[model samples]
Target: MADPLALTPKSSYAELPLRIVSAILIAPPAVAAIWLGTPYIEMVVLAAVFMMAVEWARLVGHDRNPWLIGAMTAGAPQPVIGYFFGGFDIAAILTAILFLAMLVMAKIAKLPRGLWLAAGIPVIVLPAISLLFIRNDPMGVQTALWLVAVIAATDIGAYFSGRTIGGPKLAPRISPKKTWAGLIGGMLSAALVGTATILLIGEGDIPLIAVVSAIMAVVAQMGDLSESAVKRHFGVKDSGAIIPGHGGLFDRLDGFITSLPTIALATALSGASVLQWH
Candidate 1:
């Protein structure tokens, strides 16, 4: 094991109050959409999906392929919109269009054929599917809020815990700064927050919320690590510095991307209609 002491430290969490303030300012409008159920949540999520798609393109050296990237950004939100308003029909059209464009671009760029599929599909599918999942529930806003809380709590807790305790690396190869102490601390904090949030809402199924949030915390971490692995593979930092301290949309939402699917799956299995909660 390499000495943690020897590792080059990056920016401390305290040094980024501006980034924190910016995130706080940015979150409320999106939260209000779900809280108010304005049908604009889909639009907001779509824009985020578009931003992430563009970031993915840049990550893969498609920065110059503005047209291709634009098509992808536009295509990603269609499936989510289709989930509620158009079902699969419009989504299919959008996917087909994006795929055709990818094929043309791949041939022209002479890039590895698999790169297009690997990068494009996730950018298009994940957020769109997440939107669909959110739409299935009546409390989509609250659910979305809960998801955000889970990811944020995990991140914030892990950051503080890691800083305070500062022990063994969780995955030194993928994320040099992440520590086992931080991971455990983060999970505990997420569970506490989940439990508290459920209680505050006075929900009937507190156990369900706690269990799901705990599980989602693990899943969210897995998602974060997965993105870190991607960045590590490419030898880059932050995926793009679009959100000031937050890196890119992908960086900010990576945890939600993975956990949203898990929530959707659980909701389906339980035959629970979301948005109907007390």
Candidate 2:
């Protein structure tokens, strides 16, 4: 999420060095895990979930309460999800339980923004659950890879387009850096990459997948914007300082929080992998 693409009107050459170094260090391992699938993917999901929970609690609660940490830890549902990662039903049930547990923990911690503190449980956790569930699906590898590609393309497209075009802001108040040109660039990029992914995999409804990819690109941007709104509301600059140039795990994955859950739910209701969406 934190990239040189949107730091200023044009691509920030000054920040390019750090961004490149960070991407080199982080992206390879992540791409490999998604490519590998199974236990490796689960490890990625769990690590991200835990980090996001901690960051989210701190951002909203603005406190260092040990109880909040405990709630964030419990809200992650590690062993429960770790052992049952293969089962979507187990994840769903665990999600509900964890949601309630976080709410209660929020009350117990007596954080000033208790309700916002509780909201992070689901927001930070659902994508992790979705990734786990989707990775265990019949077309797990292909589906997972396509989702990644589409999202990556969206980010790349938005970054380059927004900087290059330097158009009017998409939502001046929510995220002044974002532009309409960037959104369209992201949608177009998602459509092409998503359809190309289906072509490469030799499966799925290409036209529909293209359309969905474009829509999900919008969803991803919306997710990013929502996160911006949240940050603005809280008067925070970055979510946390975990990743070198990426601010935090939450900052890195703010978009996925929305897009992953949307696709997972759609894929689930369709009773098929995205490859079989037709």
Candidate 3:
């Protein structure tokens, strides 16, 4: 697909300024919520998840009425709420039931894009729930901060390195601009930020943090590429115009959506403090 920004010529680089401004506006409040914990974080997560659902629906060609979009978005948070009240078991059951109901509803209503709609449940809810789980842990604050830092470092490093190097494409078919250099740069940056953050503020084996950070960096990039594939499949440039330059909440949070759940699962299985080595 052709680059959307390229079509505008004069405004091709306009996205950079808008992206910077949006990040400045969003980061502070997000950090505050992570620090504040619970209700605040939960609310913020729900809101983001809802927006992502809407954007997902829009990307899949379901843009008739705003109410229908809103209804589709509503399902993303149900499982998260279930997890909060009942635990993972209940959350799992709820997710299954919800998925089946959505499939049936789509079939009955004859929604053309039912599969993607059904997919929104797990795609959006799992990460949101993972974030909640991480933030509710004893070392919640540190873990949340670590996750944010790693993601930010990965994105920033990849952006600059890819632009500067501009060599081989990481995945030419999916995201032409991404490069192997960018991937390595992102992983290194994540390792550095994650290792330093845990060492200074919390406790952990530095090597373990570095390794996990590197892995999460790769996962985050994969998340980005996956989103890009979705856009390419639908032949749309941006998911939505919700964020000035960032495209949409999904565009902005795709990395977090994938990485958080992976990290959360790692933490769960290892029984380690997210900031500390087992």
Candidate 4:
């Protein structure tokens, strides 16, 4: 029987060039920033998060007034910046107050879809905070690289595996293209990448690294699915036309946004050197 989920050979052939080109253009700078760490990665995360806020606003109909959307986007990174100066406890409190105030204001203004308008806070702030925290750790650069490797492997594996061995859809209603085979492939690839990264960086528990990597891969897929759900709810095809084949920064970084916070949390709780895992 024909595989209903499979993309036509011709269609796959047509998209391959564009996908490859887009990946080539995007991967180098991102990897460079991860390697450099600190201020550079911080800046990159801030800009990307702000762009994601803009895209979210646009999707949820909050961008009709350019100035309002612009202000909101510009302000999205304030909490993370606060973290830099005021520390996490104070920054967390301030962020909560700020988000509450924004929500109250949205209600007062009778904004359309006030809930989603409020959602723009965590959508940008949490991940920005997470990335900043992770990159500020003692073994920050290595930790960041491990994250990048896992995410990259998951995305690459899913893309190729899904395209080549398409079968049952993972979530037909949310993202029709994702498949069970692709999910398994992504998890396996993430595990492999994590193991390799740990070994390359020095000694570590390979089993623990693989387990963590697999969990992250699953979370990344969940993040992607959540974003897809949002887009579908808004009745839009893409978040924005910024990236050539990727749609928008949000579209590209959705998995990262979700994964970073979890990684950061685990790193903190475990109190292990993320690089050494010791």
> Using lDDT as the measure, which candidate wins?
3
Error of 1 at 55 (Å): 0.6
Q: Residues 61-175, candidate 1, lDDT per residue (tens digit)?
A: 6667666677667766666666666765666665666666667767787765335443565555755566556655766656777777877777777766776777778888877
Model 4: runs farther than 4 Å from truth? 1-13
TM-scores of the candidates are: 0.83, 0.89, 0.91, 0.91
Q: What local distance difference test score does each model get?
A: 0.66, 0.74, 0.78, 0.75
Candidate 4: which pairs clash? none
Predicted candidate 2 versus true structure: per-residue lDDT over 1-278, tens digit per residue: 54313434655546545555655765677778888886787777777778777888777854478777776766675533744634666666766777777667657766477778767777876787787677777887678778878877888888877787767778888887778888888889999997898788887889999998999888888788888889889988788886554577667677788988887897789878876777
Q: Which stretches of candidate 2 lie over 4 Å from their true place?
A: 3-13, 78-86
Q: By lDDT, highest first, what's the ranking?
A: 3, 4, 2, 1
Instruction: Note the residue pairs that clash in candidate 2.
Output: none
- The deviation in Å at residue 92 for candidate 1 is 6.5
To one decimal, what is the Cα RMSD in angstroms of model 4 from the true structure?
Answer: 3.4
Residue-level lDDT of model 3, residues 1-278, one tens digit each, is: 11211111122244456667667867888899999987899888888778777887888888775755876777777887888799888888988888888789889888887887788788888888888888877887888888888988888777666656656778888877677877888889999997798669757778878988899899988788888888888898888776654577777777887898887897798776567774
Cα shift from native, residue 247, model 1 (Å) = 1.2
Better of 1 and 3 by TM-score: 3
How does residue 97 of candidate 2 score in lDDT?
A: 73
TM-score of predicted model 2? 0.89
